[model samples]
Target chain A: TQLLEQSPQFLSIQEGENLTVYCNSSSVFSSLQWYRQEPGEGPVLLVTVVTGGEVKKLKRLTFQFGDARKDSSLHITAAQPGDTGLYLCAGRANPGGSQGNLIFGKGTKLSVKP
Target chain B: DAGVTQSPTHLIKTRGQQVTLRCSPKSGHDTVSWYQQALGQGPQFIFQYYEEEERQRGNFPDRFSGHQFPNYSSELNVNALLLGDSALYLCASSFTGTGYGYTFGSGTRLTVV
Candidate 1:
């Protein structure tokens, strides 16, 4: 079974601080997706990275896929209180093995206090 | 367009009882997948349905079963549930060949007593 390991299980920071969360794995994936989930709601997709060494930025958040596709990271710049939530990383295996199933990381819970 | 939708929003059931959860895929989506998320844990894949058939399943037990309809909606049925079965059950929908992200529903919170 494939497993994704995420770091910094919990994080707390003041507003305007920067934080980075990491997700690592031994298995390579066809693509990796990042999601942010608020309390009492399902996860919402933030971004998807499909290539090695790929970097995608959305406003204050920057996401990077490892060169080997076995790891990824999410960095939030000038974090605000609204950025507080649980961040999850999910990996889709290469096709033909098990299609449409996403292996997920335990996730990092971030709390940004004003 | 509306994203994935799941009902009922919350349920309470006794141990050993059977429960069925339903999901309607997003517009233009043809695949539906189920997941279980325990408090403070990531969601675990339960299974995926396509073309009214279960195409893939996770390591869950036989007590966990599902069915898909022609309209791409799906139902997850759990029999003889245990307290451990209590969790947030999420439904996600995606197109068959789209490598994009899957759209997730708000999820049904199942509490097994």
Candidate 2:
């Protein structure tokens, strides 16, 4: 079975700290998506990276897809309290809906203390 | 436009019972997908519907079923619920057949006792 393993399941730091969350997989993906979920809410998409070795930035968050398209990462620069949330990385499987559903990582829960 | 919306923001049910959760896709959406997310975990795909037909499904059992109406709204039904089923049930909507992105609903929180 295909799986995405995320690292640093839990992270807590002061408001000004920076951090990076990693999502790795042994299988290639057609696309990779990053999402953030707050308590009691569904995950909201933050970005989608389809090309290998691609990087996209949204405000202070930098997202990168590995050169092999088998992994991805999210880097938060100068994190703020608002950046505290559960960060998730999901990989889209080709032929995708059935034999390959979006494989989701367990997620990284971040807590930024103000 | 209104984003995706789910009904019964919260529900409490007992094992062996049945429960139904509703979801309405965002405006202009044509496909719906269901997911289950346990505490502190990412959402797991349950099934997806397009053109009012089930086009795809996940690793869940038959007890977990769903339906998509002609209007693109959908419902997730679970029979003989188990405690492990307790989790946030999220519904996402998107344009199908083109591999577009999805917009998710707030989710129905189901706590199986």
Candidate 3:
């Protein structure tokens, strides 16, 4: 079974602060995706990184896929109270049987206080 | 366009009772997947359905079953519910040829008493 380990299980920072969370695994993946979920709601996709050493940015969030495809990271710049939520990283196995299934990390819960 | 939709936004069931949850895929989507999310934890994959068949499943038990309809809608049924089964059930939809990401529904919150 593949497992994704996420660091900084909990984060609390003031507005304007910057933070980075990581997801690591021993197994390689075809792609990695980042998601943000508010309480009582399902996760919303933030970005998908398909290539090793690839980086993608969306507004104040930056996502990076590792060179080995076994790790990924999300960095938030100028965090705001609205940016507070649970951040999740999921990985897709190489295409094959049920490759559509996502292996998710425990997630990083962030709270940005104004 | 509407995204994935799940029914029974909240449910409370006694142990050993049976429950069935429903999901409708997003427009133009052909596949549906179910997940279980415990409080403060990430969602865990339960299974995926495509073409009215079970394409893949996760480590869940047989008590957890699902069915997909011709219209790409799906149902998840759980039998002899245990308190451990209490969690938020989420449904996600995606097209076969589309990229790896999925569109998720708000989810159904189940509380097993």
Estimate, for each residue in B23-54, the C-alpha lDDT of model 1 and write its tens digit: 99999999899999999899999999999999
Which of the two candidates, 2 or 3, achieves a greater DockQ against the reference? 3
Off by over 4 Å in 3: A96-99
> What TM-score does model 1 achieve against the real structure?
0.97
User: Per-residue alpha-carbon lDDT of model 3 for B14-66, expressed as tens digits?
Assistant: 99999999999999999999999999788999999999999889999999999
Q: Model 2: DockQ against the native? A: 0.52
Per-residue alpha-carbon lDDT of model 2 for B1-113, expressed as tens digits? Answer: 89999998999999999999999999988888899999888889999888888888999999999999999999999999999999999999987555546788999999998
**Residue-wise C-alpha lDDT for candidate 3, range A1-114, written one tens digit per residue:** 999999999999999999999999999998989999999899999999989999999999999999999999999999999999999999999663234799889999999999
lDDT: worst 10-residue window of model 2 chain B: B94-103
Query: In model 1, how large is the Cα lDDT of residue B85?
Result: 99
Model 3 lDDT, full chain set? 0.94
TM per candidate: 0.97, 0.96, 0.98
Comparing to the true complex, what docking class would candidate 1 get? medium
